[model samples]
Target: MMTNTQTSSSTERIAAEAPLIERLRAGDDGAFAELVSTHTGRMLVVARRVTGSEADAEDAVQEAFISAFKNIEQFDGRSTLGTWLHRIVVNAALMKRRRKRSRPETSIEQLLPQFDDGFHREKPQSIEVVTNGGGGSIVEREAVMAALDELPDEFREVIVLRDVEGLDSKSAAESLGISDSLVRQRLHRGRQALMKLLERRMKGIES
Candidate 1:
């Protein structure tokens, strides 16, 4: 979530990019180079988190940059150039994921929170994958990333877009070509599965 200050700053940044937008629309080489220099690092991070492969992430970012340049005339400027490029890189990475993999994914049903009939050794809800309210050692982000990679693709993509990369549910749905409700459902289950995986890993570490 963005604070008022962050929202104001984002608005100012977009406003500042307006002149560069004009230059981009007019096919200025320097403006396009500036856009690349500005956004590539973040784009690579987003791509890598989704695809879970450094090579794939680099390929997706390169493809996205080339596509953005070719499609600059069609860019409407409703989103800042970075936001537009982010969306493009996400789509590009998702495409490569589809094209690069042909393996069966494990079902996540077993990893979901277990049921208790007023009795169980422990409740899964008590576990916090990101931070525990009990002030336990916070789960490392590298651990969380590893857990995310174990999720089935259907669950992983929504989590990456909405939670890890900070795109809103609506934007995540738009990027993944799914409905908002579907995004919510997947994010919900993805988070639960992630927590369960991290909980198991933490127990192993302690043991």
Candidate 2:
């Protein structure tokens, strides 16, 4: 049986769609609540990937929601509502990155400490295959997450949108405010960096 919370959440989501579509056209209250509930989770993930910090991600999501609410009427409804919202979230995240980069802070290169060991880079073996073969332990998974965190913001955003969020290259590019070629370029570089990180970790296990 569905719990009261589940029922309420489901009902709210369902009720949101039609009302949201209408209210967005006319600019009404339901538009805001509807969008917030529907897109917040995915938007947060997008923001987190771009900003690489939980607090910054939360702020970016909030700003994105506010911007979307204000500009709802401009939405053409050609794409899924989620896609529009994802674009807004990406814009917000990129703005946050701009602000941070503009501030006087430690340069990313300066922040990195030298490593004493060498590691090889290779094509990434599939995580699913390795895990199913009982090759990945909890520590391995943590290392992968850590490597993702180390990626440059541009590389990280494309990776999250494409691989993690399952967005196509065109959609991901639209969301990131970049061209398809740039999206492909970023994804390629991002994958290479991730593969290098993973290979380094795997080498640790072998040694």
Candidate 3:
């Protein structure tokens, strides 16, 4: 929960950004530079989590910045600049991911949880999906990340956008050019696969 002071500070920050948004709309080069310098790190974090490749992430950020600059005029104050850019970055990263030759979706089925006649074959352990900079030891975090990369593109993209990037299902669906129901389905299965992979990875590390 946000305190009153935090709420007030947030309101003030948004108000302060009004002028910068206006300048950006007016084609102020300085404002554009300022926006890039200030928000590039945030955008890069989202891009990296989505693409899982430094080169791809860098390319996505570049594409996102270009899209942001070109579409600044359409940005209403309904959403914060950060929120807007976050969506742009997700879209850019998803596009880059699509351009790559992807593995078969069938490969991910083997990674998901197994069940028998509407019941688990074995009781599964609860495993948390750790997003970038989320709580966990460095080793656990790295293992979780590696597990994420091992997921097939179909499931991995949804998990990264919904869980890692913190986008809602509808937004993630739009970014992925899929339906909201598909986003939900993929996220559910993606999390299961991620946990199972992480469990094996941790066991390997322990041994």
Candidate 4:
């Protein structure tokens, strides 16, 4: 949830950017370049999380900028310009994923926690804590990213939008063209799968 101060800051930032928005809408090349320079790195991070390829992520960000320029008139002032660009890049990345060679979907049931007759997890001890006691190092971060990359597209996208991109359930649902309930379901299952994956990776390292 956004605090009142955060909300006010965003509003002020948007107001400050009114001139740039006008210039962008007017097809000013300099304004467009400035926009790309200002936001490309962050946008690429969003794209990379969803697409999981540097080349694909870059392509998606480029496509998003083009789309944003062409549709500048559609940008209402309700959100900050950066937020608007973030959504565009996410959509572009998802579209790129759809166009690529599809991978077989992994069974979420395989990743989900299994229960016995008494409704207790069959291997409860197998579930390891996600966080390292020490602040996590780069290797741990890479391992977590690898685990995320292994998730099926549906699960990965939901987690990236909700957890990685920090979108609310409503916002994530709106971005993905799904219902809020579906977003919640996917987020729950995706998180479970991620935890399981991380646990396996940690165990592998210990062995």
Best by lDDT: 4
Q: Please write out the lDDT profile of model 4 over residues 90-185, one tens digit for every residue.
A: 899989987884776667889888887769566554433544542367867787788887788888899998887778888788778899999999
Candidates ranked by TM-score: 4, 1, 3, 2
lDDT of 2 at 141: 60
Candidate 1 residue-wise lDDT at 27: 86
- In candidate 1, the residue pairs with backbone N, CA or C atoms under 3 Å apart (3 or more residues apart, or in different chains) clash, namely none
- Candidate 4's C-alpha runs over 4 A off are 1-8, 126-136, 205-207
Q: Of the candidates numbered 1 and 3, which has the greater TM-score value?
A: 1
**Model 3, stretches more than 4 Å misplaced?**
1-16, 102-106, 123-136, 168-180, 205-207
RMSD to the hidden true structure, all candidates: 4.0, 8.2, 5.2, 3.5
Backbone clashes in each candidate structure, one number apiece? 0, 0, 0, 0
TM-score of each: 0.82, 0.68, 0.77, 0.85
Model 3 agreement with the true structure over 1-207: per-residue lDDT tens digits:
111222356456678789999999899999999999998888888888878888999999999999999998898766567767877898898789778747644376777777899798888654443332344588776886888878887898888878776678877786777999999999998888887788777656431
